[model samples]
Target chain A: MYQTISENQRHEFIAKLQPVLPEIQYYLPSFLDRRILFVMNKMGFADWQNFMSYLDNDHSYDAIFSFLMVPVTEFFRDSLVWHTLFHTIVPKLIKNDPCHVWFPDCSSGHEVYSLCMLLDILNVRNRVRIYAGCKSQQTIDKIQTGVYSAQCESMLVANYKNAEIPYDISKYYTINYNSLICNPELLSNVSFIHSSSLLEDEVPQISLIMYRNSLLYYTTDSQHTFITTMYKKMNFGAYLLLGIKEGGNIFGLQALFSTYNKDLGLYRKK
Target chain B: MEIATTYKLIVIGGSAGSFASVNHILQELPARFPIPIVICMHRLKHVNSGFKETLEIVSKNKVVEPFHNDLLEPGHIYIVPANYHMMIQSDMRVLFSTEELVNFTRPSIDVLFYSVAQSFGKNAIGIILSGAHKDGVDGLHDMYKIGATTVVQDPQEAQVPTMPQAVLDVMKPHYIFTLRSMIAFLKAHI
Candidate 1:
């Protein structure tokens, strides 16, 4: 059997990487304990020492950060969330004007497309603008391409069916060489940003922010900062959608948002 | 008698024909056991409504369907919630992913076992109970390689032998305890 890294080695690896990529400082300590070596091997380095040696300049930071990004997302994930958006939230927002929506931590564009699919169904496609953000530039570029490998088609279709969408899932996309290219028209007003929402201080005021399923990756302090910053940057009466697990009232932010749907983790700003 | 004093986490995975064994394990496990136990089973996403309730009825410890980013605390049996792959992030928080199904199962046995191996290393213990396929075998091997304690039900005694037999075929586990023997061993050790 192979030997795993000792506690001392794990600490040493974190100590070495923290200076070059300070963003990892906000990750859960246990996350580093499990993933530090997995990430090292992922970057084509044999061990911690080799990874440290490769960190020769400022340019190495991007490569290191890319290795940490988990691009594991599916289209129309959590069918209920999409159902709620299409049925309840989107209708409320679009009643005022064309709503500007933001999907921070867009995670390879699944959420953006899911929302676009809903907008298209509601005949509000021309009325909405989506700003999709992620920490990985490569993911942003991939999102811009609007083509997903067909491996996810079954799951996407299943989710759509679960959400009880009126049209067949195939109506939305054309299949090419095992890739599902989203209809170009759906992506017209979508902008992809290679940025972290936690770090972006000046994003456009949004009416709906879909920040689902990514908060646990950050430390508690970062989570707090993200909550308040998002609250400040959103328009009055804006809605915030978080991971279902994150629905509990955040400390000190109860006065700002009223719970819209606790099960679906939707909050509306006062 | 000192088994409970060792590992920080214990992960158990099962699939078809597993409920009986899981119930037995939970009933035998101590409420005050000082390690967190995470149980992952392959169940249809939409039909898992009663799973936590079922486990809590037998479990002496608190049985929880944990939220994303929920901290791992001792004296609780954490059940893998529906429609997500439960991963132990390097930050020690329990994270759920809507990632593609592995081994045709979300809350994949391989995913959970490998994560516990990575997070706890020698401080982890993984046990594979009755299951239909080979989902947990690779993960058990990963745990074994990391010096974590690995165990499998005696395939001969399992309701479905394919899963445990797969583990036995790969890495030699620390113990291959049947339901009765496993309970006896824990009583003796814990």
Candidate 2:
């Protein structure tokens, strides 16, 4: 029989894991003993002996929690989201020349690319400056590389189709066998930052902020906290896009933004 | 006949805290590391896609949303698309299912781990990261059953202990380490 963690032990575990709260809240309910046992076996703990030995040694749970927060992104993900941005949002923002847009979890510059592509299609490339952020230096380097693979090309093609943006997709990439490197010019007007959400102090005022699908991992409380902070940073009438499932109700902070979009559920400050 | 030389495959599954965890592991890994990584993250049923780019930027690994029948390759990270369950085939091809969501997740970790264990056997490495539910517990056990190496992020280090701790309670992983050490282990082994 699998040994179950006592409520006390579970409490201790939760206390240890608190640094990653809110994001972990979504997964806390279903972690019964059987499930823990199953995870132990899957990780090759091999019965009780190995498990006890691991517990006895020095272990850093924060490192493990970091291992769990794998935020993977692609260029121009969710064609509809980009479509809405290009057709509806960008047009409104472009009226204000030299508009600044912020992407908090820019990750590898795909969202940057999406934004650039939108600006290019709208013929507003010279009228915008983008501030994109990622927590990893390595990703910042990749964003500097301005290269991508053919696998990325497929999605870019789809995004182009959905947004009805006109450009030869092949022209933006230089093919090397199966891989496709994005043209350097596509990234000329972007700025990259290596920062974490917890550490950011101040942000430039901007007309639009796209934080797509990045905040769902946080706990609802943290989500509210971050949203509150973001609300402070955003300009009046600034637009914010959260993950589809995220950002419907701001609890007591209902005056910040009004929710819109049936398929995408985007929020904009009133 | 001797098998052709190829990179070992590592598949990691998790829900919460996955972004930070994957980034930590990938950051510790050198650019020359010779292994492919497949990730299955729990996402909303109708969510907008951007996760692949997010992971790619954070990890600096080549990340893509896995397409139906896409050939699995080394040096690239494939993410199971949202609203679909991703699985691996005997020949290392990617597969997807639009079947009803299990545990309310389309890109389930268990489904991916089980398929990879079946396909690669001992060559496969299965990891269960931080999450709220028991989604990957069964699949990690399946990996152990198939003689593949299995790992869970030490619950002490997990953003959500329920997911990794749940595995620790049931599964006896060969190794349990923080994301840094896990990346070091994978780098050395790969």
Candidate 3:
């Protein structure tokens, strides 16, 4: 459908979205181009003008934003990084005062739950406080439900095995109606926030921040803004983990943080 | 055959016994090569250390694993990090997806080739090299359909022939050269 649109019409369509969801400016044109197709299809519109007409309708903004912000994450998505976090980083953080961990973009709470499992195995679950942040209230509500699709069970098991977890992963969940409900007791200390790192508002200081693959979705300038702001919200000697492919040197981040383990995308606040 | 005057990107895909051949190709390129190159080599998920630094030691061009959101730049070789499928977004920045595997491989050759076909179209150049199985044939076909220059390693000389043979069986690539001749072909055309 995008191929049929004129180049000028495409830009005009993007310009229409710029004000309502100001964050679109932070994404690359190609990424947005692909996503806009998904957006148009979800909104039940075939043409740009139809999309525009619906946007002008009453109470459409929230539904559009929710569609654009669907969470895409899996349990132990990057197993090797989780391995290092469990064996090295988590132990180091626990040695300090009761660890305060944060997941700035907790897209569906996979990362948060992964950390919970690690802390549980280490027998330090009582000594931690987790702050999981999301871009939308709808996602926050979904995370609170603690349900994951049954189709992902095999992949989740494979990831745990890859991470070398010694115990059976099934102990953590109860299967019901094609979904896995994570044990409610394990989530007792977690708090969900409807926030973005780019926001300048005050947030709690954290000891370890897991801001992974989501950074690639942002524009470079937005990346610089969010990373620097996130740096200020972290406590002294905190550790920051990014996606294995997320190189941090572009924004003078090297000057602010020392390379903890380049392969794992771990950085230590200097 | 007509040759394009220039290209926006060059993508190379290989697996199995391709490391030495790719290393030789990288060693042959000039320090400030005019176009950016992306290489996708199938690797074990557990083996994730020093592939970038090791390549940097021998190549004239800078070798680095592109971070997410990293913009494409000339004179550098972007190594696709293992365990993830990489796609080039319309903005020409790197987008990594942890979606289910394709062709039984993450960082699948076809995934990168399809994205390059979408982003660069006729302005892209795609090369398929030595591999154990038919991983890159579909990608080369996608590049061919989009009017991009498609090349493959000569199966006769490849350490493993299944990959190049599959492409030869499906469609005629623009060039099928051995490692030594491939470097010369690139210098002459690129």
| Model number with the top TM-score | 1
Report the Cα interface RMSD of each model, rounded to 1 decimal: 4.1, 13.6, 4.3
Give the C-alpha miss distance for residue B153 in model 1, angstroms: 1.2
lDDT tens per residue, model 3, B1-190: 7785578889999998888888899998888888888999998765455667778987999887877767888898999988778988656778876544679898899889888887787888899999987777887898898888999999999988889989999999989999988888777777
- Candidate 1 chain B minimal-lDDT segment of 10 residues: B1-10
- By DockQ, who's the top model here? 1
Model 3's CAPRI class is acceptable
Quality of candidate 1's docking, in CAPRI categories?
Answer: acceptable
Model 1 score (lDDT): 0.77
In lDDT terms, which candidate is top? 3
Better of 2 and 3 by lDDT: 3
lDDT by residue for model 3 (A76-188), tens: 87788888988888888888776788887776777787789888988988888888877667677777787889876776787898898687778888788899888767788
TM-score of each candidate? Answer: 0.82, 0.51, 0.77
Worst 10 residues of 3 chain A by lDDT: A1-10
The 10 consecutive residues of candidate 2 chain B with the worst lDDT sum are: B1-10
Q: Per-residue alpha-carbon lDDT of model 2 for B18-95, expressed as tens digits?
A: 778877776666664577888888875334556666667766567766544467877788777675667777777665
Alpha-carbon shift of residue A242 in model 1 (angstroms): 1.5
What is candidate 2's lDDT per residue for A109-207, written digit by digit as tens? 767876786788778887888887765566677767876666767666765676565565566667687776777687777777766453363567778
Q: State the C-alpha RMSD over the true interface residues for candidate 2, after superposing those residues.
A: 13.6
